[model samples]
Target: MLPFENIILIDKKSSIAVYKQIANSIINTVRNGVLKPGTKLPGSREMASILNVHRKTVIASYDELEAQGWITVFPRKYVMVAEKLPLLHPKKWDETELAYSYDNDLKINFRIIDKSWCVERDTVEIIIDDGHPDVRLSPIDELLKTYRSFTSRQPAIKSANKGTAQGTVRLREEMVKFLSITRGLTINTDNILITHGAQMSIYLAAQLLLNTQSTIIVGKPNYTVANETFIQTGTQLIEVSVDEYGINTDQIEQLCKKKKITAVYVIPHHHYPTTVTLSVERRMKLLELSNRYSFVIIEDDYDYDYHYASSPYLPLASANHQGNVIYIGSFSKLLDPSLRIGFMAAPKNFIVQCTALRKMIDVGGDGYMQNALAELIKTGELKRHLNKTKKIYHNRRDFLNDLLQSQLSEYISFTVPNGGMAVWITLRKDYSVKQLQNTPLLKIIRTDEESNSFRLGFASMNEQEIEITIDLLHNLLKKQ
Candidate 1:
């Protein structure tokens, strides 16, 4: 007999009964061919003494093994391995099978798509991102307190686990009230669906609306991620030029006349890459075109709350009477991007479809965080934070603009934006982004080739960092 002590080691702390553990160990040994058929096992009394388990425990293990056809028990005499074990099919091993490489058999059919937008910099110290918010301003303590409070309550914990994909009812209700007062929209909780972020909302919208036969009208230098999302849906993208006054609506109307456009994706408030607000005249024209062409208008007002100069334009959804607009917004800009909280506002039927699709992908959003945000909104903490950040961002924006004009006037030309986080600086045609990126002093900033612009985000940086970044850019430009 193989030493029973070496074969079966019982764990007293395990939740599994001692007898079951012994039975499982013996079964595993049998399956592994460590114990051959017809091999005799120790008597229960001797096994119990060797294993340091109760004699009854050893008897129960032997009984279980016999019941499962792993062993046969002779009448009060001995326990032997069964001639044929349960659920075991012994196959002869072929040495030739080991010669084949899995690499050829396990091949990936899909092509890898690169979605990297930011260049990796190892030595760069200052980072000028694409209009990201300062997470230092986040009320982490208050949020944690609210989260702890919710988790401490049994009812809240239970409700969180059973939350709907459309998000918690309380958060939805709070969102309805918040959007109504801030964006001047008359909407209820039924018209809203909370999403992971604006990116997820864009993807869900694209999935519901577009097909291979559909055409999506977008700005020439639009949000790259949104453009990629539409592309992944197998839809044709018709790029219209975006100037100082936003996407050319006249061109969009011309496309509408030629083809049956499915949707028009626009960042009308502050166009990505170029922080130019859509002219009021063009906004009206786009709305009229959407109504006439029967195309869905995807208005991505991502950073709507970060306006500095003047009152921001009301979202297209607020004036959309024909129900052709699906407005997407995110609190990621106001809070932290990692929070991943965004909302989509559309017709109730559309929202219902989005909710169903969202359920298929994700069971629900973070209920605790959503509930905490709702509390912040209800108690005016979110509003106060926004107000405070707005002033700080506005100051930073102005300061960055002054530094750019004073230092980089010879090498770059830019228009000061009315109400966005970053200014769009156009490097002189002679200078290449590649050359700037190679320079050690200017590697921190990201330059876009699609728009011939550099989006220098000022909202996240302090005055000292901003000055240092500007000084570095000035020195780099002077070297050229």
Candidate 2:
């Protein structure tokens, strides 16, 4: 049985004040022991419907009841009977009630907005989840074999901070070999600083490179987490518009001449939210601008490992001649989020200061995880596992795209991302994002764009789950 099953909704539209009438009914119920402690009162919608008035009016009455200690309202979605509050209560209505209503000039209540259908957590969603990179896809057997080999050796375990901040010699050496052969990035261990995640590396760069006086430039509709971090650090955020070719290098040149822009952040391989890759020509132009402007380029190498269509772009850091580009990379994305291990390749001059900043922020990453991850890469388990996981995620992405194209394309425009776990979607102009947002069960952030752009998380959902979510979204959009 549900709580607060008793109290009948009483609606009386009269000259008497609505709040008073509602309050009077509740007081009477409590006085007669019809309402008990720890009982949840109906939501504003439920009460307003029963009383045939606006939900706000019922809320005002509840507010009055709560102020007088007759009841309580929680920040969470619940109103309840207060604990042991003594109130003057009458079993039945008195003549004074009519006289009080006449004096107060109360009239009617407003109808309630139906809000019971949506789950609140869906309001904001995380971009990366624990399920991606399908750890199962990784050669767990191979990793365990390496782990057993490591444990079985019983070699002296080094402290996390023993080697250069770029990471231990063994790991950095492995990465140098991996990037040199794969991405054509010729980086040595001295040029790289190992970090917890690429974001943490980004945050550390912000701390070391930016302060209250610095102005950081980012693309419009940027990654939410990076934006939040910038705001917290009090750095001025400059939003540059992006074209189909990726970030408009022309706009960036203009901004550098005008504003005191310190750092530029870009997702060159697969741009966040929007899957447009920075074309090779634009990357060269961006690198040139960074040199000309005397500012550092922050290349977020996010999802560089999961290229499905086009070849991955050579990173901005790979072209750093002026020592101004800070190239960031991470395995947490394809390997595991919990691994909390990534590397930043910066100019040799900035490594010490960046290390100081990194030490102050997290000191050192986990030795065990680092060693295990290094072993995974050293033994080729990392690349082997990533391929398997990417294939699975690619299938899920295809399924979602097919559903949207078949059923939702008439209402929404979307492109399959060449890489990454998220798909960028633009809703039809016929439907306003604000309307969809206010609709019941619509779980999205103030949304990525003022126009209707929503990111669908396919990494965590199975094909069936993705189908259900798409159907629900279709119904919701159709209603609007």
Best by lDDT: 1
Model 2, 267-341: lDDT tens digits are 888777676788888898888888777888888886678877766767777674587888888886776566677
Q: Residues 1-480, candidate 1: write the lDDT tens digits.
A: 578788887899999999999999999887667888999988999899999989999999998999989999997888899999787554577623222244245466875566675447767666678888889987767887998999999988877665559988888899999998999888898999989999999999999999899999999788888888898888999899999899999999988888899999999999997889999999999999989889999999999998877899999889956988999999999988899999999999999999999999898899988888899999999999999999999999888888888888988998988887787888898775667667654453557775456788888888888999888877777777
Q: How far is candidate 1 from the true structure (C-alpha RMSD, Å)?
A: 9.9
Which candidate wins on TM-score?
A: 1
Model 2 stretches with alpha carbons more than 4 Å out: 1-132, 135-153, 159-161, 164-166, 432-446
Q: Rate the local accuracy (lDDT) of all candidates.
A: 0.87, 0.73
Q: Where does candidate 1 have its weakest 10-residue lDDT segment?
A: 95-104
lDDT of 1: 0.87
User: lDDT score, residue 174, model 2?
Assistant: 78
Model 1 pairs whose backbones collide: none
Candidate 1 structure, TM-score to reference: 0.78
